[model samples]
Target: MVVKTLGKEDLWCGVVGGAALATGGGGAAMPREFFDARVDPLIEKGVKFQIVEPQDIPEDELIFVRLGVGGGIERRMQERCLRRFGVADWIREMDRVFPLPKWAEIPDEEWARVAPYRRLVELKGREPFGFMPFEIGPNVAFEIIRAAMLGKPLIDADNAGYRAVPEVSLGTLNVIHAPITPYVVATSYGDLMVFEKFLSWQRAEDLVRHIAITSGGGCSGMVSFDEDFIKKGTIYGTVSLAMKVGKAILDAREGGDDPVEAILETTGGYRLFEGKVGGTTREGYGAFTWGNIWIKGTGEYAGHTMRIWYKNENQISWIDEEPYVTCPDPFTVVDKKTGLGLSNFRPDHWPVGREVTVWGMKCADLWRTERGLRIYNPKHFGFDIKYVPIEEKVE
Candidate 1:
């Protein structure tokens, strides 16, 4: 078990595979262009990143999971606001209006002396948080950057495995009954609001979404505590898993192998359908994109149809109205040729008649257990069927 360091090359694949793992849910995939514009500068100026295996995490230290919250519809609206208000000036305004807690930079010995005191104040009565991701994405990059800043190790475990769900309650954190309070939400405009308690996952979800909407439709947040509490709850090696999937896709393209096959082979996924985008309709709620998409068959399966229902991530699939695949399992649509994931948020970009491949993979092992199913059963999403694994449902 050797530890691996992730650098420039891995970031590209990490982002690509992490987005695919998001399973058409999660926040919009952070564009490579955006990465170049926003993150490259930080790297150029000496920020570095490395991913440690979860087993390597020191039990004595605290860990935190960080992520972003928002919807595609609101994201679009926020972009318009940014353009009108001016990014630089607006960020400065946000800093003035929403100040974050600041701590002084000091030597390790001095910091160690006060760390327990600081942790005591932060924890109050809450249990320690885990040292992994809730889900991977551009936020993983943000976490890596934060880890670099704090001189802490970023472990490669992620609570959701690779499938991103729409709510905080949908994660391993909730399943394990970990306290998610004492979390911090930092707005794009620089406002930081901390929530020290929540009565329920639903309440926390609503509060986070409300903050995101009012604070310009997006925010970076973190749950911090000691590492011991989340060790069993998290599924390890997910970041490396994403990197492997991404690397396989790139390898396939350059080596003239089938990219889609490469993706399936690398990720142990099965192709559910090969078709064209047929039609789609969506509904926007508090901070989620819920919708159904139709993919009409082509080639060997001509004239057949597949329907997928999504709540951020793809939830259920129907073959001509027959229940096919459902949530707690991953359902993703990718470009047939390039093997790139198509955001459920932008089916319009996928367009009618464009070739796409639908892939299904088992959700994280944690998501398949009794408690996991309790949190993610089809009934939880208002579907009538008892939960079935994707492998069982797919022909």
Candidate 2:
């Protein structure tokens, strides 16, 4: 049951941020890189951060949400009828109703423009619930320090999307009117202070992006404070849970155990396909640079392969050329090295000539949810279809 940490040094630097980034509009970005940037410059001028998990976030504390994951908002959410998010029922049991809207989807051109800060950047808060992206190492640490001074709950999981996206407003936050004061915030830094306040999250995001463009790409604010919303809206335990999954794989590898064996012991996920990338297609349209992946079977599953597709940052859907998932029930993605998990990282360009397996992160209950239709299932993410009771087992 014991698992390993994300890296040699667990401390503040963890593996959840990237995955958070990958979650796009689904979850919040892991501010590890951003936090790193703030620790110095902002800390010198007074910035702070606190490490807390979903469970640790005080239910009564006023909070705000932020994004480490953000790229674009879907302009045609209503038109597309996309439902890849958690079931509203399950989500309601976990927390308040904060259904996010797909705002503006990222244009591939603009995406290329913001790619640097998009990955491994620190977002700090200064005002009541302010935030700024910090690329430099020192500023990241400074932001963490400032968050600590806020004396509010900084839950480990991002209540918002993953990655350093366009702006905070792009998320379903403002549209849902979930009362967004509990997330990231920014302050002082002079002109940076103007960024501290905005008429709406949309305005704030627009301002921030403009700042980034003006600054050559992306800009980081010294203050990132969003305590109120933390006390109110946002998903709680998902982030910590994601970190736990990654750590489990890392730990299993360190323990000299077959990571897949360890993962199977941990997640009841199904190994839907084991193959190599046989095909690739990139669809770049307006704000989207989408792609599709094809898996050619090998080993015991020879003659059966799978095909997966995705938008710029998410797994859009899957079509098993073999439909083998009927037996596995769900699909999955595991580390090629340990066969544990592909966490934060997923399959992109195949044909690299490597043995691989695709698993699904499915639970029986997930299949019955409103979003249980084709493409929205756990198999969509290439996760094996199985649910592990880690919450109960670990507890």
Highest-TM-score candidate: 1
Name the lDDT of candidate 1: 0.71
TM-score of each: 0.83, 0.49
Q: Per-residue alpha-carbon lDDT of model 1 for 1-395, expressed as tens digits?
A: 34566677687787677666667865455667886786678678877677777676666556666645766345555643352364456544445665534651212213322343245446555433224667865356555655665555568887787777777778876777777877676655434566778997667877888776665555557676456655777878888888888788878888988888988898889889999999888776555777888999988767789999888778888888888888888878888887777777775556888898998788888787788888887898888977778888765
The parts of candidate 1 lying over 4 Å away from their true place are: 1-3, 29-34, 37-40, 72-131, 188-191
**Residue 373 lDDT in candidate 1:** 88
What tens-digit string does per-residue lDDT give for candidate 2 at 1-395?
11111222232323432231232212222345654563446447543334455334333332332332222223452123222332233333323344534552222322322332222133322223222222111112223333454543334434222222223543323433443322232211112222324566655555554443332232333223244444333334333444444556567667876655555555454445577767666543323345656667788757765666544333432444322332112234444565432321223324456566665443333223343333233444465654232122123
- What's model 2's overall lDDT? 0.37
Q: What do the candidate models score in CA lDDT, each in turn? A: 0.71, 0.37
Runs of candidate 2 exceeding 4 Å displacement: 1-8, 11-13, 16-50, 54-61, 68-153, 160-233, 283-287, 317-319, 322-332, 339-351, 363-395
* Cα shift from native, residue 50, model 2 (Å): 4.1
